[model samples]
Target chain A: MTAVRCVDLCKTYRQGEVDIKALDHVSIEIKEGGFVCLSAPSGGGKTTLLNAIGGLDKPDSGEVYIAGQRIDNLSKGELAELRLRQIGFVFQAFNLIPVLTARENVEFVMQVQGVPAGERQRLAHAILDEVGLAGLEDRRPADMSGGQQQRVAVARAIVSRPALVLADEPTANLDSKTADELMELFRELNDHHSTTFVIATHDKRVMGYAKRLVRMLDGRIVADIKQDAA
Target chain B: MNLVFRLAWRNLWRHPRRTWLTTAAMMFSNTLLVFMISLQFGMYGLMIDNTLQAFTGHLQIQAPGYKDDQKIRQTVADIVPLAESLRAELPSVSIAARGTAFALVSSEERSYGIAVFGVEPAYEPDVSTIPGLVSEGRFLGDIDAPEIIIGAALARNLRAGLGDELTVLGSGRDGSFAAAVVDIVGIFDSGIADVDRSITEIPLGLFQDVFFMDGSGHQIVINAGSIDGVAELQSKVGSLLPAGQDLVVHDWDALQPGLKQAIKADMSSAFLMYGILVILVAFSVLNTQLMSVLERTHEFGIVMSLGLTPGRLGRLVLLETAIMGALGLVLGAVLGGLVTSWFSVNGFAYPGMEELASKFNLPARFFPQVSPLTLLVGPAVVFLFTLLAAVYPALRLHRLQPVEAMRAV
Candidate 1:
């Protein structure tokens, strides 16, 4: 089953007198448990497509169905609920709230979902351990290294057992070794938990971890590449 | 709902600078509001007590038609039957009966026209402190005592001291002429120059002789059992007056209507000023909250996109405001309360108003007393105003879209 499907998705930005098309007639689908890398260079609409899939941006003219619900038809609150319950985002900047600890950041999503305190703590600890940061649960994002922070971000994204996770350059700020290690965690979560992973990145290391690659340029997907069989 | 509240609590600390700025502004306004109001209440109480105690002896009784027209020839003599009825019915500490007459008091070299207050010396002390305020010699000895306590300035004008004889001449109640010889037994300085310059206290018998045996007082001053008992005593005393007699009883307030009117007017004006100021402060509070939300537009989107409801987002903003307001209110009230308590105990003085103070016959030291209303009313008023201020900002949050918010960055 497809965890996310977008047909002819488009987004436009109007600056003063000029209209900029960030995404134009983009169409794609990532099935459940699939590790798909949306690879593109700068200004190739990789981030825009990821934003559209994550429910953080609405398509101007097409349909986006996340877990069978047409996101374009949902209200703001409904979209928020969809994102909270089913979709998780790992931003390029690792945008963990500066004041919250690693465990707390992961627990925040569950907290908004109205999970009990004890259950939230338990789930947050379990996810932190899964991401190989068991004893670093109380450390803040600032206190962690760039790689550790991204790992915490990855932990937070998968903590809620979201149906699909969209990571926009999750390893962009880390070195090669750390980036490969982070990709291994993503592959492990995808293989073990069967959670769908959609990564938007320019890094070749990240692209190597994908079972399929969708390449984009100038606001359009130009190539769709599949590696070995699943 | 509880989940939203949990998030809202954490949201307040997201930007410590903005939160503290808003709280500080709120505290500033609250302090100003509380202190100004407390001072106004204290000043009002002081003015009321001073004006009454200075002249009006809680309650005063006037003869029928005498207050309306002094020339009506209906002196206290007209109410002889009513006077006996009053004494029988009212539980007065003492009823100091007096006849007032426009008279000329003459010395060997100079003469001055004055208002004479005739009194029973034995009853005078119970109603007024005029006898106690004597500066020289002595006051009236008995009902038949021919001695008089001359006004201090009047004594100076006549160059008369103790044991000097003065002739008093005035018209009788029957339109006949009357004359009497009186000795200046003492001099009284009533502090208020107007009263001290013109009022002369004479014995009731001497006053009756001067007014040609009127055999009654034009006014009966009644002293109640105590200040606290004045209201009850006034009610009981009202039942004593004869039904047919035209009498008007003036309480302390009625006796000094000018002072009461001034205080009422000042209090209303002060209240209006403070009320407007509080509303303005509330607007500043609103501004602070709105600014905070604007600054965190992207963060709000993050929280909302994380599955936080619009209601929850709005509630978080309101809760943030409430926490800020509650904190400011507590601090402002504590500071305001401490100042009020200090003023209550030590009494704040406006030392520069000595002349004005003296004119009003107030003491040199002015002590502003703080009431309980000052302490409690300020916090309640601030809390209500603050909560009301948060509504618009909280509502504004509901109107914000999560997509637009997330795109804010």
Candidate 2:
């Protein structure tokens, strides 16, 4: 089964008198448990594609399906519920909620998911530990470094154990060492939990970890390739 | 719900200074409102009590038509015994029988027309403040003494002084010629210009002699403990009046019919001012909440992406406002309550207050009446307005799109 499928997705943006094609008749499919990398240069539609897949953005004309269930026509509330239940997203920067501590950030998704408090806390702590942030559970995002905040965001995204994780430049602000560690963690979650990963990034290092790599230029895919585990 | 409160409370502290400034605005307004309302009520109470004490005496038992027409013949029958019986039946009440007649007073130098009150000297002190207002000589030396107490203004008008023989001429209860020779035994400064300019008092017996009455008086005044108890006591005392004796019972409001309307007008003006103050504070809160939400737009977008619906987010902000309002209310109430309680016991008065108070026959020190109503009304109004103010900001959240909000920069 396809974890995500977008058929003829098209989105447009207007700047001054110019119409910018952010997505143009895009069509793609990623098999269940597939680790895919969507690579594009600045403003080439990687983030836009990730947003569409996560139900954060609606294309001007497109059909989006997650786990083979149509979701492009969902209401804002319905889309939010779908994202809350089945999808987890990690943005490039400004990920963690500044007001929440690391453990609370991780617990937030599960908490909103209506998981029991005890179980939520247990899962949050385990995920924080898995993200190498066990003792820093109470550090707010502002107090944490960029790398630590990214780790917390990653922990938050995976805490509820969603079926799919859509990440947009997740390692953009991290140090090379932290970036590699985060990619390794992503790979571990993908292999062990069969959690499908679709990461949109410009970083070649992050792209190196993908089982399938798709490259886009001017909102059109120019390359589609597959590779062994990093 | 607990999670929402936690998130809301945490969000409040994100901008501690802004939150405190808004909360302080609310608190200060609440405090000022409570104090102002209490003072207004206290002043109203004093005004009513002083007005009633002057001559109205909370309640009066009178003949049916005497109030409308001051006919000396329109008298409550057997007034002395009737007043005595009322005083005995209601121990807490102070009842005095008095007769009033329009008479001509001649003091050799000048003759002036004045309203003369005939009273029982002993019971008059309990039922009226006139007995305590004498600034010269004394109040009706003895009830049966052929003496009179004239107001200073009246004395000034009549050119009469203490120890001077005054002649009073008036028609009697039966329209017969009634006349008396009385010594001015006292001069009272009632402070009220209207009261002082035309009022004089004499013993009830002498009044009867001068008015040609047979143990009957114009009215029996009763001061029943406090103003708050007047209506209940009026009913009880009214029930005790001799059945079918053709007497009317009236409370102070009936005696001075315009007092309630005057108070209502004044209170409406006061609340209008109070309403403005509350709305200003509410706007201050609203501005703070909007700024806070605007600053946290990205954070909200993240939360929304994490599965929190816009409605839940809106509710979160409202909960935040509610928590902030509740906190300010409690703190402000406590602070206002403490100040009001202290002033209520020790009294609050400004310079020249004594002179001002005396002008209206009011107490020198005015005590604030801080009832539950006073305490709750101000803070409750503040709370309600704060929530109302937050509605605009909370509704703004529902319009935020996670995709767009996350890109707010």
Candidate 3:
């Protein structure tokens, strides 16, 4: 099954009287249980494409589908519901809600999905332990180190076992060892749970963990390559 | 809903100082509103009771035209018997019969035109404060005694003192020439210049004989314990009137038309000031909530991207404000009620209130009424306004673009 797909996506931004094409006629697809990395330099439209796929942003023109469901035409509330039920997202920074602890942040999506408190608590604890944050469940994001905060964000995204996970610069603020460990965790989750992973980054170390690599420049796809697991 | 509430509560304390400052503003305003409103109502109660009990009882049964025109001929016949019958029916009420006429009262050295009232001296104190305010000598005792009690200002004008003979001259109910020589038995200083200068009282029997009233009097005054019960008392008294008698029952409001108007005017002005205070507090809330929303723009975006609807996010903000408002309301009302209750028991007076009250024949100290309505009305209004103030900040959430919002620092 195709876990995610985009067809002829186009988006534009105006920077002080200059039109910048963030995504221009971009299109891609990832199959079920696929691990794909989108590589791009700064201002090269990777984040915009990820946002469009997650239904967090509307394209000036195109179609977005997740698990074979067209999402680009959905309303804001509908998109939120779709994201809550089907997709999980991890941003580069400021990921966890400041007022919530690590466990609570991990349980946020399931709680919104109306999961029973006991079940949510059980799942949140298990995910925190899996992310190597066993004893830091009660710590707020501000009290955690950069690597730990990113781990918490990653735990929150995949804790509910979503079919697809979209991560933008997931290792940008992490040290080298922490980044490698995080990539290994992502790979383990992808292989064990059959959860499709889409990560946007320019880091060669992060791209090495992907089964497929897609390169972009000036909002247009420039290369598509398949490789064995790192 | 529990998670939302928890999130909202936790968010409120993110900046504890701002939350506390905003809550304090609401608390202070609510407390002031409670106290001032209660005090105003209390002062109004005093004003009404003082003015009514001073002379005009809470309700008066008078000849149809007598209230509008104090003509001697327009009198309630057998007033004393009627009042005695009412007193028997309503044991709790105080009843008195009176006859009024404009007469020339002359002392040995001077004379003046004054309104002389013929009162049932024994029952007069029950319905009026004037008899209790006698400053000199004694009130009239003998039912038919040729004696009178004049106000100090009236005595001063007529140059009369206790035991002095005064000549009372007036027209009778039959339009005949009425004249008599009466001795001054008492003098009262009511502190109200108009009443003191213009009013005099004599024994009802003596007045009947001297004025040829023929068993008739002008008014049957009744005091029904409190102003709150006056409406029911008026209805009761109106129904009890002898059939076919051309009499009307006038409540204090009817007898004193200016009183209600004065209370309404004062209330309008006071509420305007209260409205200003509530609005000021609401603006303070607006400032705090707006800053809170602006500061957390990125967090809100992340939450939105996490599948939390904008409507839900807006509701969360409002919930936070509501929690803050509830705190202010409960705390402020408790504090205000405590302060007002103390004053209600001990009485409150401003500087020089005693002297001012003495000059106007009013109570020296005022009590603030601390009923639930007074305690809650102000705080409830403030709570609603604070919620309204949070609306602008909550609406800003709907305008957020999650992609752009996550980009905010």
Name the top TM-score candidate. 3
| Model 3: lDDT to the true structure | 0.91
B11-108: candidate 3 lDDT, tens digit per residue: 99989999999999988888888899899888888888888888898999999877887888998998889988998988998999999999998999
TM-score of each: 0.78, 0.92, 0.95
Candidates, ranked, TM-score = 3, 2, 1
**Which runs of model 3 end up more than 4 angstroms from their true locations?**
none
- Provide DockQ values for all models, in the order shown: 0.40, 0.64, 0.79
lDDT digits (tens) for residues B201-264 of candidate 2 = 9999889877888989989998875788778888898899998798889888888887788789
Window of ten residues with lowest summed lDDT in model 1 chain B: B72-81
* Fnat across every predicted model, in order: 0.64, 0.68, 0.87
- Top candidate on lDDT is 3
**Which residue pairs collide in model 3, if any?**
none
Ten contiguous residues with the weakest lDDT in model 3 chain A? A86-95
lDDT of 2 by residue, A1-230 (tens): 88999999999999899999999999999998999999999989888888999888899998999998988999989999998999988888947877778888887778778888889889988999998998999888889888888889888898888999999899988899999999999999999999999999999999999999999988988899989868
Error of 2 at B12 (Å): 2.6
How would the docking of model 3 be graded?
medium
Candidate 1 lDDT over B206-298, as tens digits, reads: 777677755767777776644566777777767666677676676766666778788778878887887887787788778877777787887
